[model samples]
Structures are given as structure tokens and as C-alpha cells.
Target: MRIGIVGTGFMGTTHAKGWVETPARITGFCAETVAEAAALADQYHAKAFASLAAMLPEVDVVDICTPTYLHLEQVRLAAAAGKDIICEKPLTLDVETGAEMLRVCEDAGVRLFVAHVVRYFPEYAAAKKIVADGKLGKPGTIHLRRCNYRPKKAAGNWFLDDAKSGGLLMDLSIHDFDYARWIAGEVKTVFSTTVGSMDKDAPVDYALTILTHEDGTLSHITGGWAYPAPNFQTGLDINCERGNIHFDSVASAPIRVLIREEQNAPDVGLPASPLAESPYTTELKEFYHAIAQGEAVRVTALDGLKAVQIACAARVSAAEGRPVFLEPQGGVL
Candidate 1:
């Protein structure tokens, strides 16, 4: 398949590298500037289009790695052209836009895949499999932490603007929110607290959110841009009735499991495995395969919509200093 990538920023470049590892051809790119698109296109031996409309007919699939705010328009254009779409996380900045994007793609009869890459991370994927296999029994409390320095190279410092990037919670913490839902089921309410600034000159920002799931599972998710260095760290702790699973990026062995005595399960310790290929590659390959085979994508557009809903709710809870209860629509909050 021929792929057209939108944006030439970090995520766009990352997606370009990922598509290279697959059998698909990197047809071209459309970015904020022709110069930027041309720079990335040169690295991939591809063309640079001045606009999305100009590039649409040349590619079979459109990989949208643009900023959160640009997603709705780019998706609408691509879907209108009958091109399958691969959009980056959070889908859009709010529920209304995300819902409209999904509706347009559905009406166009084109497949839409959201790139929730955290789900493809080896440790996270393994933990999910364990839960699916009933190895953890009924999960109870989940704690997730993802911390990193604020993006020093984000174009125009967009990451600091809550209006543009949704600050740390929507852009950074959304991963943990999606993962929490994946493990614990639907969220019933969200309570959150935040610290620090959204100012461009601010050095630190942090947010902590508690998600109460319908199944009685509680998820405490923390995200921070307060790290002094340009370091990234993530960890997860899952408590289940019969046992527990844990992962820490800083740990010698990142993944560990322990079962209660009555459960009679052997403990498992998993050291991080060296990757022959990046998880981004694996994620893109799966997306391509699903399109090719006319099968269901691993990450659906609805999953993306729900994640945005949960993240938006978290923001509301933080702003109002109260628990935000979710009302279900067609069994999804």
C-alpha cells in the first residue's frame, strides 16, 4: 500500500520510520511548510505535497501524525477521499470533534485506526495478555506513572498550551487512561488534581487523576513534566484478587508478578527484552495488515473516542475540584 504522512514533527518522523519497516511505500508527506515536508520526504526517498487534497489521490492510506488540534480536519479530508486513516492518540481535543471524525469515517465507509502506541509496548501488551488470560484474576487497583521533561523542541512550544496540546493530562497522561480502561473496564467517574503551570516559561507541571471503573477497579494515574532532565520514565502496578503484576522503567527487571499463597501460582520476573524492531513498527504493521485483510484493527476509532472522553473528564474534574461522573451512551462513556 502507498502511505501519505501528514506532519513532519517528531511523531510524523517516527511514523515515517515505522512505515519503512513494513512493505508499504511512503508515497509522500504534507506538513505545515513545504520545506519541512520536503526535509522529511528526502530522508524517506518520498515526495512532498503542498496540501492534503493534492496528495490524497496518490496514496491508499493517510497516516496523520499532526498535532491534536489538526486531526479533525485532516481526518475529514482523508475520509472524504475514501482513504483509510491512521491517526495519532487522543483522536481530537474533545468529545464532539472525535465523535464527528468517527461519524464521517463511518459514513465514508473507510477504516479508521487510532495509533495508541502504548498498547503496543511490550510490557504493557504482556500485562494486558495476562489479564485477558485470567492470570491476575479480577483486577482491583491500578497505579500508573508516566513522567518526562517538557518538550524542549516542540514546534512553537505548543506542548505548554492547554488549548493546543491539552497540557500534560490530555497529551501525556492519556496513555495511562487508555491502558487503565483496557485493563479495568469502563470508567464511572474521575477525580483529579493538578499542580504547576501551562505557561511557556514554566519549568514544571503535574497531574494526578483517580478513575473509578464500573467494575469497582480504581486507577490512580499520575503524569508529570517536572523532571529536571530530558528523561522519560513509566511504571505500572496492578493489584488483582489472586496476585499482582508490576513494571518500572527504572527497575533492573522491569516486569514482575507475584501470586498469593492460596492462589498457588509461581512468581514470574521478566527482564526487558532487546527489541529487534521498535513497537512503533509493530503497531504500524498491524494497522497495515488489518487494512489489507479487511479485518478489525487492534485499536479502533471508538477506543480513541472513549480515551478522549476520559481525558476530558479528568480535566473537568481537576478544574472543578470534584468527581465527574460519566453517563453512558450506547454502553460507552
Candidate 2:
């Protein structure tokens, strides 16, 4: 599949590399700024365009790597141009725009995929499989930690602006939100605590949310861009009825997985593959196949929506100091 990427920022560049590494062919890249587009195109060995309109006709797929506020319009443009879409997480900064994006893509008969990278992480994927196979017993409670030191360059930028990026819950914690849902099933309610970002006037950086899933599972997530350093960490611990498992420090090599029973200490497994490819590459390959076959994508627009909804609910719960329900629609439980 021929693909056109919009935006030449960090995520844009990362996704471009991922697509190139995947089976799809990179047709071109477009950035609002011509210089950025040209630079990325040169690096990726693809054509460069000054605008989305210039690249749409030449590519079968449009990958949106733009900021949150720009997603709705860019997606609409791609949809109208009859190109499949692969968008970054938190499809848009708000629910209405996100829903509209899905609607337009659906109406245009274009597949919509979101980049929820953690879902593709090898350790997380293995954890999900183990849980599905009942090896983790009945998933009872989960504790997750996802955090990073915000780059000084990005600390007070548009990413921190609630109106522009929807702050930390939407911009960052959404990953953890998606993973929690993926592993444990539907979320029923949440109570949260949040603090304004250290460097910005907006609220994008810090939060701790406690989620209650419909299956009587409790999950907790803590995320932020306030580390003030370059390192980042992510891990999840699952406590089941009969056993427990943990996947920790997955971003680096030798990812660890710990398993234990009621009477045992634990068994730890390290990375088995010496040269494992990145999860981003795997995710894009899946997107290519899903689009080609007109099949449901691994990271569907609804999954993105559900994640955003949970994040928004968490935000409300945080601001109000109360638990918020992940309400059923149309009286359907």
C-alpha cells in the first residue's frame, strides 16, 4: 500500500520510520511547513508535499501524525479524498470531533486505525495472551505505572495546553487506559486525582486514576510528563484469584515477566529474542493487512473512542473528587 504521512514532528517521524519498516510503501509526506516535510521526506526516501491535497491522490493511505487539535480536519480531508486513515492515539482532543472523524471515515468507506503502541508491545501482548488463556487465573486487580520526564522542549508547549492536546490523561495516560481495557475488559467507573503540569499553565502532565472494571476488577494508572529527565518507565502487575504476573521495564531490552502462585515466591522470564523488532512496526503491519482486507483493525476507532471516553471520565472524576461511571448507552448494560 502506498502511504502519505501528514506532519513531520516526532510522532510523524516515528510513524514514518515504522511504515517504511512495515510492508507498506511510503509514497510521500506532507507537513504544514514545507521545510519540515522536505527534511522528513529526504530521510525516509519519499516525496514531499506542502499540503495534504497534493499527496492524497498519489497514496492509498493517509497517516495522520498531526497534533490533537488538527486531527479532525485532517481526517475529514483524507476521508473526503477517499484514503484510508491511521491516526495517532486520542484521535482528537474531544469526543464530538473524534466521533465525527469516525463518522466521516465510515461514510467514505475508509478503514480507520489508531496508534495505541503499547497494545503492540511484546511484553504487554504476551501478558494479554496469558490472561486470556487463564494462566494468570481470573484477572482480579491490576496496577499500572506509565511515566516519563517531559522533555524541557515539550514541557510548556501546545502539548500541555488542555485545549490543544487535552493534557496528560488524553495525551499520555490514554495508552494505559487502552491497555487496561484490553487486558481486563470493560471499565465500569473511575476515581481519579490530577495535578497541573509543573512547567505549563495547562493541565497535561500528572494524574493518578483508579478504575473499577465491570468484571469486578480494579485497575490503577499513574502517568505524567513531569519526570524532568529523559528516562521513562511502564509496567503492569496483575493479581488474579489463583496467580499473579508482572511485566516490567518493557521499553528496554531483557523485558521481565514475573509469575507466582499463592505458595511460591516467583519465576522471572527475560526477553527470549535477541533481535526482536519493534511493536510499532508490528502495529503498522497489522494496520496494512487490516486495511487491505477491509477487516476490523487491531486498534479500531471505537477502541480509540472508548479509551478517550475513559480518560475523559477519569478527568471528571479527578476534578470532582468522585467516582464516575462508564455509563451504558441506550440502556444496554
Best by lDDT: 1
Write the residue-wise lDDT of candidate 1 on 1-333 in tens digits.
999999888788889989998899999999877887999889888999999999999999999988798899999999999999999987998998898999999999999999998888888999999988996699999999988766665247777777878878899899899999899888999998888423435568899999999989999999987775535678999999999999988784434455444432111111234587778888999998998887665678888899899999989988878999888657532
lDDT tens digits by residue: candidate 2, 184-286: 8888998888876223464236789999998889999988665534346677898898888886674554644455534321111112234457677788888
The models' CA-based lDDT, in order, is 0.85, 0.79
Instruction: Determine which window of 10 residues in candidate 2 has minimal summed lDDT.
Output: 264-273
Return the TM-score for candidate 2, rounded to 2 decimals. Answer: 0.88
